[model samples]
Target: LPPTGPVRPDSYDFSFDSYFSGIGGSGFFLGDPKLLAPASTAPTGAPFGARIASAVENAREGIADHIRSSIGGSEGEIAAALIVGVRAGIPEAINESMRRTGIYHIISISGLHMALVAGTIMFLLRGAFALFPDFSSRRPVKKYAAAIALASIAAYLVISGIVVAAERSFIMLAVMLVAVLFDRAALTMRNLAISAIAVILVSPHEVVGPSFQMSFAATAALVGAYAGFADYRAGKTTAPPVKRSFLKFLSRKLAVGVGGAAVTSLIAGSATLLFAIWHFQRVSPLSLLANLAVMPIVSLIVMPFAVLSALAMPFGFDGPFLYVMGKGLTAMIAISAWISDRSPVDAVGLISIQSVLLATIALVIA
Candidate 1:
């Protein structure tokens, strides 16, 4: 292979001979790789999928370049990772800190990112529709907003390079949005199951991968926990409360928000515990504290600015938004580093297959 040509990833068709690794005593190795043919130069030669992928790659590069030019430095790199799913420029030290503190998913395009994007779009669209009383009174504005949000997420999925985690998140979110269109419950176990089935059908091998297992586990646990909470609340009846002072009301709302974030961190961490041990052989004991400290910045400031900056990019108004977003990113990184420094050393020894299976079974049952 030469470096001079316009060679796409899928441009070359190659064949290789496989052999057992003599020294490693595990896995096979490829040898004597041969290039069979280059991609066709004809207008209609490339496969549709390949062409779409190429365009996506180009878009990702363009986005990355724009982010770098606007933000610069590691913040720009993090922005690129968060928005376009490109992390090649992020320093390894920062990545290690995030991984140790268990906030690495902030940089990874996953369910949280998808949810934020969809939720923001839905919120804005619904609010806009609500301003028109006549229209809102007569039409199913929620369904229209959901439909548009779905389309936005589909575009986001393509922009993010359609990785396994992003794909799974998109499927789950798309199902929820579709449920809204049909006036059905969106976050039920049935919808989760449907999303899981869809992902497995598309990439069955991913079921055994860490991204698939950890993602689904966390989602299942969160859904089950919230569903149980909803049921419990439904069963309990309370008299109407007396009105409180505005300060008291605000404090109570803040408390509830913090409590919810804490509960979410605990649930997701517990659900992914076994998978983390099995795949990475480490656990962040301070992850709950880290999430509590940093998630507000991410959820409230970083992601919102990310969305705003993206929307404003075409009009050359993203500079200020990106600057504000960078501040939030800086705070998040600092918090993660602080937490990582205090985190306990990695847990020793590998967990056995039986233990992993048992934990997985227990998770499923729960």
Candidate 2:
């Protein structure tokens, strides 16, 4: 083993004896290692890319610090995870609870978070432009909003550390925003395929990782299901109702919202089930119920306030917004805890690689 010493910028050379381990084990073990090194000084200046990365990292830390100062405790940790993909401070128990409840993705900073951020920004921008009808009508306000939203997504990608899931989401979203700019269909299998190809091209190794596989699997399933539903709706020949009561309309909207959330949870959970089990060795039986209960809080309360808080931060008015976000996060954590406590025991035994491959093929055909 190398001797313990002060941290240094010097390169090192190691010499060691290697031996093979017992059956069923892989890789050689090193024995009687010796280290040799030449001292070197640290670089005086970073490359441009490194400088930009350092700035984004500092900004991410600042945002996390602000969240902790304002919210504190587990809620602050969760807020940091949700907004900046910083999960380092989340307690192991809380993390386990979320995983058991099948809502761990809530903290993972993936498509849902990115979509909400971009959508909120676009909505606000378009609304602001609509206040001046003459300008809004004269200009392509939607495209302009898309352009800004795209820029926001890019900034968010950097700030969130550009993990596999975030990278995939960014690519997909960028394609959609570019589609909008070109007056083309945004959400389609073709666009998704493009995004997938782009991701694979950039990070081929990630294709084998759970983050890439499960993220794409869930997205593909959702897109296919929604596209099929769209086709089914298009085929419907029934005439629209000429009149409806306001109460009935409100109830219908509520029903659709609840049903959509439930369906989304089911589809995504089902799609990612194999990968989740293969990677983590757990099955979340109550995931649908947990998602149904908590997703609305996340979507309607947590994320909206998250965006507001971020926008309000520069003005020092983020406290109220962060507090509201913390309230929603508190509720979400409670719900995860409750559901996780009652979740069934995980499935035992290993699944074969062939089985996973077959499932993937079936998913594609579907």
- Best prediction by TM-score: 1
Please name the candidate that would achieve the greatest lDDT relative to the true structure: 1
RMSD of each: 7.6, 8.4
lDDT of each: 0.85, 0.84
Off by over 4 Å in 1: 1-49
lDDT tens digits by residue: candidate 2, 1-366 = 433322322211111111111123235467884658522322348687877777777788888988998999999999998888888999999989988888888999888899999998998899999899999989999999999999998988888898768888899889989999999988888888898899889877667667788888888899899999999999989797868899989999999999999999999999999888766556888889999999999988999899898888999999999999999999999999988899988554557778889988998898
After superposing candidate 2 on the true structure, give the runs of residues whose Cα lies further than 4 Å from its correct spot.
1-43
Worst 10-residue stretch by lDDT in candidate 2? 12-21
Give the C-alpha lDDT of model 2.
0.84
